[model samples]
Target: MKFADLSSATDYLASLTRHGVHPELDSISKVLSELGSPQDKFPAIQITGTNGKGSTCVILDLIYRRAGLRAGLFTSPHLLDVRERIRIDGTLVETDVFLEAMQSVCLAQEKTGVSLTFFETLTAVSFLVFSLSRIDLAVLEVGMGGRWDATSLCVPEVSVLTSLAKDHTEILGDTLELILQEKAAIGRSGKPFVGTIPPEVLPEWERQRSLRGFRPLLRGQDFDGKWEGETEAGERAFSFSGQALSGTYRSSLTAEYQLHNLLTALATVSVAPWPVSQETVRGALLHLFHSGRWEPVPGFSAFLDGAHNPEAAEHLVRQIQAVRQENGKVAFLSGFLREKDWRSMAHIFTEAGDHFFLTVPPGTNGVEPLTIASYLREQRPGIDCRTGSFKEICQSAFNWVAGEPDRLLVVTGSLYLVAGVQKWLSGDDSPLHAGERTSASPPS
Candidate 1:
């Protein structure tokens, strides 16, 4: 139950995959039962979406923490390491802590011989750790589909659907509406659920949520954004109503498409079971920051995002359009895994951004660099892309962009790619900027 046990714990956790194909609620329920029903301990703010769930979860955490509540957070596919998946009051649970939790889960599974998939087991550990920490609330992000997700065990007081789009077609469905249905499964009877799906899909989402027995808050219908003034920096501001609260503040993430997520977070907290004040809402927004949402990091001044899908890539472009002031070279550092919607996403980024520093980070879902570069070159005839060591490629891009301060270095493709950069630049690989909390976590 110490740090030295991590390797064995990891093997034990990995062995849970032998449970075979993922099933519905019962498979997950059995795993949680092994942990003594930790999922029932905390009131949760459940979030599910193709993208932006992570951002909204961060915003919810900030608001809850601002209101002086101990909040627990759980997200997927950590950028740097596994410990990022569990957090109490914004600080990540330590390595030793995770190893201990894993030991408990593995021992329970072994004794019971209860089969558990990777996500199910991890979700169980996160819930147990959070329950033991005595968090006032937990902001749980769904791994894939909404209804059957391991985190869906708890019936949340409020569920947030943050801006749906077409991404996972295989397991979910081929169309946006089908994917929306799968994601919208997070809703429960009488629970307040907010739809962050774009305006086009709002009608079906509305009908779906109503049939599911939840109060639905649909964007572009219930609330209206009025043309508002600009910040001194000339940022666009919109005043939107959230049944109970509204704000016309500038988003620091610099992604134009993030408005949907920001509003979704606003609506979620407005109808939350835990009471919050207007001052708490205002205070939270002023200092809000998610790890990688077109974030402008220091020194290299890189723009980081975890967009690996076609729709997400399109959203990132819209975000870039909002932030980019003038003409500048964008040095791209990217990677992708085998199952990614690469053909769809390829056109989204390859057509807009310059070229890429394609790489395959060790122990990651990142697509091989040669494969990515070749595909990118074929898709976009004029683009220049190359394969190289991830570290050198990231460094070269950063230095190349740093020389032209006006230019930008866009690092994306996968959270695994971002984690490789974070591990080297901010990890123990370098002493320059150590202990920095790089937001490398992303939804698969």
Candidate 2:
């Protein structure tokens, strides 16, 4: 069946949410095989991590394009449009192009007689688009764990693990060591595996690298970087020293914690076969962009971030604290998926803000706002906590910060929530509801 429009195509994908996450590659493999194995047409650099993988993938894609290479990038959980998940030459694929690719994937699935999940279909579509576009390389971010993620089918020239933390524990594992093994498995036998890991997981990472027989380029050992002071134009300045390359760079992305992601991207490109000059790297950094990560709403004293888990929440809190240092009172408008360690995140957030507005994201797995509000009130007796529908909470948060110039509202917790807020901010009157449980699966 061919889709006549983008809406029809996306509806078809949304319906696949019923299949949930199978976490295996057999079905995607069959679909790709029937479609002429498009993933093999271009070399790839596959990245997997609990956080920062999307940022790293985008950074690498920008650098490749700046160096005169056509790079295709595939990331997950689009903030606004599903087309955002697939980009070629640093531009979102046109609607017509996405629909065409979806048609091909649909036909292939029918011919192969293999059912695919929402993410699996998108993966196949990305590969098909890149192959048809004749991209010089592809930078793929794993949707979840590495071993069974459809993106793992590619034999990457270099594999990257950005950072490890407790997330998707229900599927990956319940401990840090188990999580590391699942993510680190993205490394190909002879390829370079480059990334940074917490000190606690270093030993386990080493064991995984030895077992997989992939070259290890650990951060602070094989390569390292330091953050310099911010530039006058509000860009972040950093210096990188790696095994294959070294340079001082500046990024338009000003989040302090993004320094680690920048360093990871540099390390990945340094060892990859593609050649990128220092000048190109510097040029690319001057215009880098990633949405919904500490994104400031225009003409408003608010920011949106998708920090769902405790580790990411910790990074976000550090940024919030910096704002507080300037006599700013921070307030959070937050929502989280039920599967996440929301209690730990709530604990961290309490240290960042005194006022909270809680709401459920537009999906089945989102934690109820009343439940989160009750927990917060119990944890912090005098804290100002309120619960309501997502839209009501957003209006209340905006009104709370309306007249106080020093009060900053932060919309965060889940990317799904951030997307809803962004659409609301853009004056889209359509009901802000995600169609189904199609993205990441919640724990059983």
Candidate 3:
């Protein structure tokens, strides 16, 4: 297919990922080889886990770039734009550069007659951009289970796993042990691997590390971080102490649970080949901000978080309750995708928030908004719940929050919902307002 603009190219790629899973690296490896294996042109750090991987990537990128290294960061399911998935030296690659890299991958696929998944093509494009820009190092977040994930095509200097939980069970496995087995495959021989793995999954990770001849740096045993306190502005004061480095850092990021992700990133940096000063790490933490992970939208009184799964939802509830003032009304704007633990998520949010606004996420995978409304009612009878288009929900949420000074609004459940709500508020032409009809039953 011929493409004249980034939108068309991205739309075509998105179509490929619908009901997606072509879990093999042969096609991506071949396409990269055709393009001179751009992924091998630079050193990379691979990160994989069920959660906290994106936040860990963001922290590592901040530290590397702040230390004056030319850093390339590639993550998935961007919160605002696809360009956000690929960045060079702390800036999104220019539109022209993104399109040029994508075009090269398209040509390679046509020549090789190897169809690539949406994620595979984007991964190739990121490598191409990194090669063209001559980045010193790249930080890659694994798109899914790591064994055959497209982003695992590169040979990483360090492999980091943030935290494991129940997600993508159909593709990964039904149990945490099975899921950890897939994620543990990212570690290679002689490569430094680090992460916070649950006690139950430690044996599998150890087995992989032993077979691969790589030493695994455990989170609590090898390194740890503590949330020291919070400022009046809600900024967190945290400290990281490891065998190599120890320091107290301040961050504008307020989520208390992120201290675990921060420590994992710090541990990876400490063991990485690159040299970064404690001062640089401190500075980077102060300015670090990642969108849609307890991110507060500017010019609005709401916070956005992608707390899709039960584990993440538990964290979201704690964070909200911690910051909420006594007698303050907690208002929520939530939308979730299908196949998620919507019943658990509903109970969590309804317990934490006094009022709820439900909206459908931006695609066919969206769980029907009213389906969640029903779940919320079952959990909390007579709960203040309303549903409509994204804009309508936001308008209602804004009006409700405005009624009280101590009210706080949290937008959570799915990243797609946060992105859609952000676009609607930004006055962009967003797909969220379409609000297509659906009567799908909520997950059991």
Task: Name the top lDDT candidate.
Answer: 2
- Look at candidate 1 and tell me the lDDT of residue 161: 80
Please write out the lDDT profile of model 1 over residues 1-444, one tens digit for every residue. 333665576676556566754648786576677778998998998988888888788778878888999999898766655666777888888777787787787677676767678888788889989988999999998988786788889879998887677766777888777888888888888988887567667777877867798888767766545535433342345566868777665444335666677677777777888888877876666556666566556665477777888778888877666555578666677778777886677678765677677778556556777887778778777688867887777767777777576776787777766666666666563211111223342210
- Candidate 3 local lDDT, 1-444, one digit each (tens): 567887887788788776478767888899999999998899999999888888889889988988999999998778666788898987778888898888889899999999888888889999999999999999999999899998888999999988899899999999988898899999989888998888987788778877777778888899988988765464678888887768888775668778888889889999999999989888777766776777665545568888888888999899988888898889889888788887788888876896889888876478778888888887788998899987788889878776466889998988888888777776874222100111211000
- The local lDDT score (0 to 100) that residue 429 gets in candidate 3 is 44
lDDT against true structure, model 2: 0.85
Which pairs of residues collide in candidate 1?
Answer: 79-440, 336-367
**What would the per-residue lDDT of candidate 2 be over residues 287-374, giving only the tens digit for each residue?**
7767777776666678888898988999999987765547678899999888789989988999989999998886547888888888
Please report the TM-score between candidate 3 and the true structure: 0.94
User: Any idea how many clashes model 3 has?
Assistant: 0
Residue 134 in model 3: lDDT: 95
Model 1, residue 388: C-alpha shift (Å): 1.8
Model 3, runs deviating above 4 Å: 429-444
